[model samples]
Target chain A: MKTLLITLTIALASLSALAQGVKVGDKAPDFNLKNVDGKMVALSDYKDAKGAVVIFTCNHCPYAQAYEQRIIDLHKTYAAKGYPVIAINPNDPAVQPQDSYELMQQRAKDKGYSFAYLFDEGQLVYPKYGATKTPHVYLIQKRGADFMVEYIGTIDDNYKDAAAVKEKYLADAIDALIKGDKPTLVNTKAIGCSIKVKK
Target chain B: MKRFVIYMLLVAAVAASCTRGERPTGELAVPIVDYSGLEPYLNKSNDTTYIVNFWATWCTPCVEELPYLEKLSREYSNGPVKVLLVNLDFPKYYDSRLLPFLKEHDITAQVIMLDDSDTNTWINKISPEWQGSIPATVIYRGTKRQFFERAFTYEELVEIVEEF
Candidate 1:
């Protein structure tokens, strides 16, 4: 019984740690979520790809809205090259009505998004990735059967003006991965709206 | 009696001027300042605890938490705390959005515009734990500081300030 108690304690401790989600160099976790097109999509669906640009963004956030065109352009530029932009709206609709699945679908159609925009329903996927804010980017590259968290944080240095962006962090990371090399600048941060999770 | 009437009129005019100082009339000029003008406010060597809140006009949670910050500033008016609302609104939106929002809310805390876009380098300089999210706040007394990246209730905000 004493040994059982110790084993249980260790199990709970590890569970709490896993709850904090993935970090750099860690194996990226996979999820089967519904896309804006009413079809189910998963990271495995992009099995043929070299890497993935998993972006947590929402329709309501001004920061996310500002990057919409940039994100669309990223998908257009990289989808044919094996690294595609996988947009995810991690915000709970109950908390932010504008980020609801219906609105997400509308935004995807209206914006002419060429990539898979998934909805993290029941608020499951984001916390597993430890996503803190909208417009947060996690670049994952597949190695063997597992995808590794190569880079985490923002898309670029500037969110206000895409033309003014000096450092394209996401594009740079993807380019390096394509060349079988590590990114020169791995991680970055930018002022973004906090992910609207349900209370 | 004539001298007394003149003195009362002078006092009334001086009182009106003081109120004007708190809030300027006509088109209010929102000072657009860079990090140089802001460094002094953050690096004060005095005993006052500075509660610096980073916010933008478009950020929902930031706007939601603004009231709590405003309230805390008022409650701690005579105390050792000073609240500074650093507006991170885009320079283009300063006249169109930010200034109008400030005027509409009648925000009492000291507000200033931060125009720098090199956030990746400076975010860590502000706080290592900051994820560069709005509604983030830094409470500091001299060099000792604490940074919170999430929204805070009035009670939660006061709890932190009172602890310092």
Candidate 2:
């Protein structure tokens, strides 16, 4: 009975760990996802960089589409500042055909995307990051050899009109990190389309 | 006799036009509310079970699972189960997108548009577990409440409602 109880406890602990994804201050897991350029991209690839602004987004979601230009602008403005945008589409093509890898490549090319628009093929990465929706931002800062999640949530306060946005949550966090000061507002929420995963 | 028949047809056409004019244009007058206005619907001290679903017109899974929610409402039309659809479509799309979709689908349940921009503050109030994803649902009755951050089929929805 004692042996059985110990085994059961271990099993339960592992199960919960697998279920729960990375939270703020947690060491963000590295992934080798395929980029739109037909090359494998990994977090370690940006070893010399200060941090990365990881966004889990897709082509089909209107919310994601609305933030496309803003995401591009974020990369353009911050890439040289040591915090670049790493976009990964975590949707399953079987569930949402529009988010297929072929279309991601097409979208990147059409938009003249300077950053790597990666495909989290096999739907493996987003769940690990606890990304429940598209356009979910995970601002991970480089802490020695590990990338620690500093901020998580929406790109800004308003998802409707960019011009009218009052609070730039992701950008503000990046700016704070760059200035060597901790971000005052670390987390935020926004209405977004749920990430597509094949059942 | 031919002239008399023509007169009767003209009378019937005029009557049809009048009835059409009397009927409401498929546009439903849904209340657009902020988080504060929506809070009361989330918490009602009544005996009825409120199955409130947060969805948008653009969300594919949310759209797919809507029929099941509608069916649940129909099944318990006179019962204690009440289905409330909380639409999260952007305010601008309310007229151009949301209203047309609701009208086209003939959604019979009570629907209210959530126009609150401050989601970070209100999302936790709805449920701390909610990651601000659509197709989320909250089933509550008086003080007893449960939140689900997932889509449901008709049978699954019925099973959960039964448990409540």
Candidate 3:
């Protein structure tokens, strides 16, 4: 019985640790990383703005690639109002053959991204945001001086078929914030490639 | 001179052995079938509960939850419960990832790589709310199947396995 208790404890602890990933109501982690332009960017940099859209992304991962255009559209639509999409690459190029700095630049330049494409070298920022996959998005809204994640989830309900899109989770969340209302679906799931880290 | 030659040959032998690639393929990797394809593998009379975990090599939570799933499989082996892992590692993870990953860990449950094109057709086909999330699981007993997202604990797993 004692052994079983210990096993149970270990299992719970492990799950708890593994599940450190934040949910909808969790506070967004603060981070500062060098963007593609070699300029330092921080979550606080956007403090003066109404809110920010924090997204984990990379050069590889077909799933992430699939949302690239949609993400661009989101930034184009919302940056003027308040929320600016901050795309962060969480993969360590040292481990991921496809996520090298050079490839990232090529991808960004080719895609004509207007948002900040920061590199999370060593993945110091991803875990804090509780991000699990590429293209994972967290919407942070600035209430007073602090920021909290308002909506966390997929870009939209349609990655497979944009023509058949029925729901727009991120877009709706931003719209809710604009209307001074909290988003209804704050936490949603995204399917994408895993972020690779170097040992 | 004789001793030096012997040492060189021994070093050469060691290097050759070390470089000889992953273990000889043991059990053939099971293919992750679509919802329609899953019909053949499932026994209709099986009142025994079955947990089918959908995972991939690149997915952190999926990889992390493997051992716990293995334990669940072990527990079920003693009774009318079963666990099957559907690996979404895809074909890309085979050489650069899966084979090496399998060799590094001691895995006991059956592992399958689901190679399906056009995820759109299958996402809803598997379950309406899948949302393409990895580390999701589908638990079944007879005609009933309960789907769960997120990783599992041994106790939580046991509870689900024994529920039916």
TM-score of chain B of each: 0.79, 0.82, 0.75
Note the clash tally of each candidate: 0, 0, 0
Clashing pairs in 3: none
Q: Candidate 1, DockQ to 2 decimals?
A: 0.61
Of the two candidates 1 and 3, the one with more favorable DockQ, higher being better, is: 1
Winner by DockQ: 2
Instruction: Give the DockQ (2 decimals) of all models.
Output: 0.61, 0.64, 0.14
Tens digits of per-residue lDDT for model 1 on A36-75? Answer: 9899999988889988999999899888888899999998
Clashing pairs in 1: none
- Alpha-carbon runs more than 4 Å astray in model 3: A1-12, A15-19, B1-164
- Residues B1-164 of candidate 3 have per-residue lDDT tens digits of 99999999999999998776544556555554544666444445566777788887766657778888988778678677777787766565566777678667767787776665445456556677565657788887777977776677788887766665
- What value of lDDT does candidate 3 attain over all alpha carbons? 0.77
lDDT of 3 by residue, A1-199 (tens): 9999999999999888677766666667788998887788998888668999999988877678778889899999999989999999998887676787678777888999999999997788998886767888899888777788888778876555566677888899999999999998786665666567543
Please identify model 2 stretches exceeding 4 Å from their true place.
A1-19, B1-28
TM-score of chain A of each: 0.90, 0.91, 0.91
Candidates in order, TM-scores: namely: 0.86, 0.88, 0.63
